[model samples]
Target: MRISVVIPAHNEEAYLPRALGAVAAQTLKPLEVIVVDNASTDRTREVAEAHGARVVLCARKGVAFARQAGLLAARGEWVAMTDADSLPTERWLERLTARAGGAVALYGPLRFYGVSPFEATLSEQGYRAFLNLMALLGRPNLAGANMMLLKEAALWVGGFPEVEAREDVLLGWRLRRLGPVRYVPEALVLTSARRLQGGWGPFLLRQVRNLLGDPRGYFGEGGERER
Candidate 1:
């Protein structure tokens, strides 16, 4: 099956090239690369077009809306989701597809970049532990920055809700009811730690809220989904 990689970006001119470059270098080339310009005032659209990514404008201004627009515009059978500040591995798509047996949607861990060494290491270990705990509880957290889903499966569940955060997990919950949702550790991506600028105090609280499946994490801050 062909894969279409989708990126939701908002004024990510500085970081978008890395993501688009990774997509360009994927072992299994996606059928297309779509960059959803999430109401950005910068050169997001220009950068995406420069990298040969088809630009789709999401004027409503939210990750959920941007993702829904991508799901609708995607031409491939499966849609790969990643953030503007994230870099999927060279074989990220290949690995995810290889491990996908009966799973309709699956996500993997993220190794951070642009952050301290401690934060980078913590991201991997923390993700592993969280994945394990959520799997045991039957609520796999499909991160917006490192997950892949069948276009049909995602759309059938009403796409992403209009919430500010936890939209990825919400979609995962909906897909779990339809079929198995697996966590593949090998399908890793490198993400930016700009969001963690506040440090681990707020980070740990976000983790707790994530476990509780709370939608109020980034609600007041902005509509951008957690990266």
Candidate 2:
């Protein structure tokens, strides 16, 4: 499958290079790498261009807007969504394509970078269990940090909701209505634990709210608006 990797970055110059480097080292090279510059005053665009990623200027400055902009500019049948602070494994894309089959959306588990290998494994396992349960509930937990979807299917579903929170989950739910949304555990990604550094309590609480079908609870209005 021709895949286009999209990373929505806003003033993430320090973290963008590592993410782009991981993409460059992917065993299954993508059709294109689109970096959405979300009105950043920093050198996000230059850094992306330096890493050979085609830059898509998105002045809207919202995570959802950046994601949608990148999706619109993608020239591949599949779109691999990842965060600017995420480092996907070398075989990430390879594994995704190997098990793609007729699945409309395929997502894998993610672990933090600073955590121990054992801790990462634990995190991955926990996430996989959560994902399996969510799938049973007909709501696949598709995080933008490690999700791949058919471009056509996503567009047909009207793309990501304009909402700030749970857009990824909402898209997964919408895509699941069309066909299978599978979880590929072997395709793993390592992301920064910056969000959880504050504490797991707040992070887990927000996630719980989302899974409870309430994205508007914590992050909906004037709270952690960016991805």
Candidate 3:
């Protein structure tokens, strides 16, 4: 099956090359690599084009908009989504494709990288514990940085919801109704821990607020789902 890798970038010139390199080195190569430049002020477009990736410029400034644009442009049987700052393992695509059967959507694990020792331990342990608890309750929150979806399945859900945050979770819920979403732990992606640079206290607090349905803290005031 043909797989298209879509990367949403915004001022990510410094990291785009590495992410694209990882894609090039994948054991199971993707049919195409698309970089959606989300109104970046930096050299994101130039870097992506330099890496031989097809760059699509999205005038909108949100990740969701960029992702939807890429999906619309994708011509592969399956679409894999990853952030500009994240890097997949050599076997990432191979593992995802292996697990794609019998499911409409697939999600893998995301590991935090480029962090201080203290921050890394805390972030990793905290998230693992939180996910374990959620699993026990039969609730799973999917991460966009390590997700794959069939093109038909994505179209059935009307594409991703153009929200500033938690779009992955919202879309996962919708896709789950159409078919099962398989979790493949072996297909891991390395994501930057820059969010922890702001301190875990504030980060965890914001996550808590968001989980509690505080729309202001999660999606901002009056932030409804976009078409």
| lDDT per residue (tens digit) for residues 1-227 in model 1 | 78989999999999999899998998999999999999999999999999999999999988988999998999999999999999999989999999778888989998878777987898888878988898898989899999999888888877786677778887887789779888898998998888778987897787777789764543444333433
- TM-score, predicted candidate 1 vs. hidden true structure: 0.92
lDDT tens string, model 2, 1-227? 79999999999999999999999999999999999999999999999999999999999868888889999999999999999999999999999999899999999998888877887777677777887777777768899999999999999887887777677887787788789999998999989988688787887787676567654433554433222
True-structure RMSD, every candidate: 3.8, 3.8, 3.0
Query: What TM-score does model 2 achieve against the real structure?
Result: 0.91
Cα distance off (Å), candidate 2, residue 180: 0.9
Per-prediction TM-score, please? 0.92, 0.91, 0.87
Q: Note the Cα lDDT for every prediction shown.
A: 0.87, 0.87, 0.80
Q: Show the colliding residue pairs in model 2.
A: none
| Candidate with better TM-score, 2 vs 3 | 2
> Candidate 1 at 105: error in angstroms?
0.3
Which runs in model 1 stand beyond 4 Å of their true positions? 214-227
lDDT of 1 at 173: 79
